[model samples]
Target: MALGVVGASVCLLVFLAILSLDIMGFLSWKNQFPVDGKTVLLTGGSQGMGRGLGKLLAQKGANVIIVARDVKKLQAAVEYISAAAKSQTQRFHYIAADVTSEAENIRLLEEATTWNNGQTPEIVWANAGAAKPGLFLETPLETMRRQMDINYWAAVYLAHTTLKNWLYPSDASAHSTTIQAPRHFIITSSSVAWCNIAGYGTYGPAKAALRSISDSLRSELNLYNGARRSTATTTKPAPYDVKIHAVYPGSILSPGLELENQSKHPVTHELEASDPHQTEDEVAAAAIKGLERGDYMIATNWLGQLMRVSGMQGSPRDSLLWDTVGQCITSIAWLFIGPDMEGKVWNWGKKNGMPAAPKS
Candidate 1:
């Protein structure tokens, strides 16, 4: 009876400590940013996770502008979002533009701003991505380049233009009194960025580059925000409340994932079996929820979260105490588990022949 009471007292102490941390902002317990009646620009919004996000955001009364290369898919997505909209004034627009080209991304940004009555998007979702899985030596150089272009460069271009032209524009007229909402930039990376496995040579590296870019952008934006505040004058609007969020999603049942699965080596399947794939709707919900909560890094599942904590760099800490504890646990766990997992994948690859080398 004495031991039971002691255990209960210890649990209570821990719970109260956590509560205190949350109240002190050591754990992120702040109110979520409101999305209602805001303009959101989503790329790769034609199908799969992007479409699901558009529909969900539209239901929340956001003016959603979806951009993709497929006109038919874009139109279908727009219709779906429009149909699901909560308010009669909730707007859904689509722009057919390939995000891989910097010039095209610039044009798309212009179109998005025009569609939103010259108001910049309060949220920019850089969600366009692709993957080509195969042996690194066997994969065509063109294929590797294409993957990088679509997944990494596309995000860079869009984010660059978004910041230069709208979020932190040089033109003073770009600032509008009517639309001074908090700005968010959300990018879709993959779990492979940290939890890499075999047969993902091209795709994993591309995502890793994206992770790096997002980290750098977050740092730059922080500096910019600080500078703007320090140099603020009565003549200019307050500095933009811009926040960057990077999502590291595990497998999801989307067209892109389906394509990747079709060509993925068997060893890849074994590595991923530990984490069951989520639906497009589930991923979309989690991504938006993370953004609303103002998280710097978002992961959709336990494995993704574990991998993120294990490989975490300089990303913002939502819960300092919890995140630090998780990081320590994951770091120690990965020291043994990571090697064993890699050994299994290596043995599987050795048993099965790799893809043929590309013709010289």
Candidate 2:
């Protein structure tokens, strides 16, 4: 009798383990993706994270559009993506316009609408902006204004333009031979949005503003009713609102990190390491994965859900401590257990004249 009881107990334990594993697998799969042919446009697509995303989406059968002020560099990027995606039909486009201008933003969207091979682009990633890492008093006022122009103003202007032009509802027939489509707008944010760092007098504020705007837009769009025929001029979404996702990440290793180190405020923010600088290709892969899964918050190098849980708690100091420690252990675990592909915040130790974050 005792042996039979022990056998039953063992069977119950095994069943519970399998159930738990299945649940966890579903949660993880919630953010993984199947390939999507949806069109995507990336601003600041000349290099770094933008270029990375442009290539990944193109490779995934997406019609990718890249826009920046550098024409020669843009052509080079097109060739690079063409090689990466290996698809002759993977259309690559570029429009040279400074995003800060409202007229320029509108013109870019108009161009995007026309370039879609008679279809509308359904995804847009606004990754253009300036980040001057310096103390508030040390950085020039003009630099701060420029950050706001590119970061906050340009993003919303593009979001509004994309909606009004490409995603807007029209009188087309429901029976028409058109594919059912949903649009999405993704904005790049930072951890600085939640906690302002010591040297982000300029960079932090602009990201915070972007965070606020993205939240408000998401809330309003979610409340919209599509059946209503009323014309709302506000930045509201249609009944089936386009998904707006905010990607909050820490330091990214880009060539711009080299320039940031060279600026007059040399020892400003942290820079990436030479060995483990997370390539732009990796960042782009993670982003496309997150977008296809419709994740609202994608922390590319997420250590664990602990950071998000900590962010939900009150007390600024406590939040910072939780985030810093969790991120460290999480990153360390990646090195030891998983692939080092998860994002890591590293220090350059003044070799490039960039200020290193005080040792965690």
> What's model 1's TM-score?
0.88
Residues 1-360 of candidate 2: C-alpha lDDT, one tens digit per residue: 999999999999999977875553423445333335667778989888888887777777777788899899899987887677746766778889899988998888778867875545677888887676765666678888888898788898888887665445442432244444546788987656755544677887888777777777766665443423346546433334356777766556787666665553422333222213357887777667666555665656653143333343331221234456866665565455333222122232324444445332
Off by over 4 Å in 2: 1-35, 170-179, 225-241, 264-277, 303-309, 312-360
TM-score for each model = 0.88, 0.71
Model 1 backbone overlap count: 0
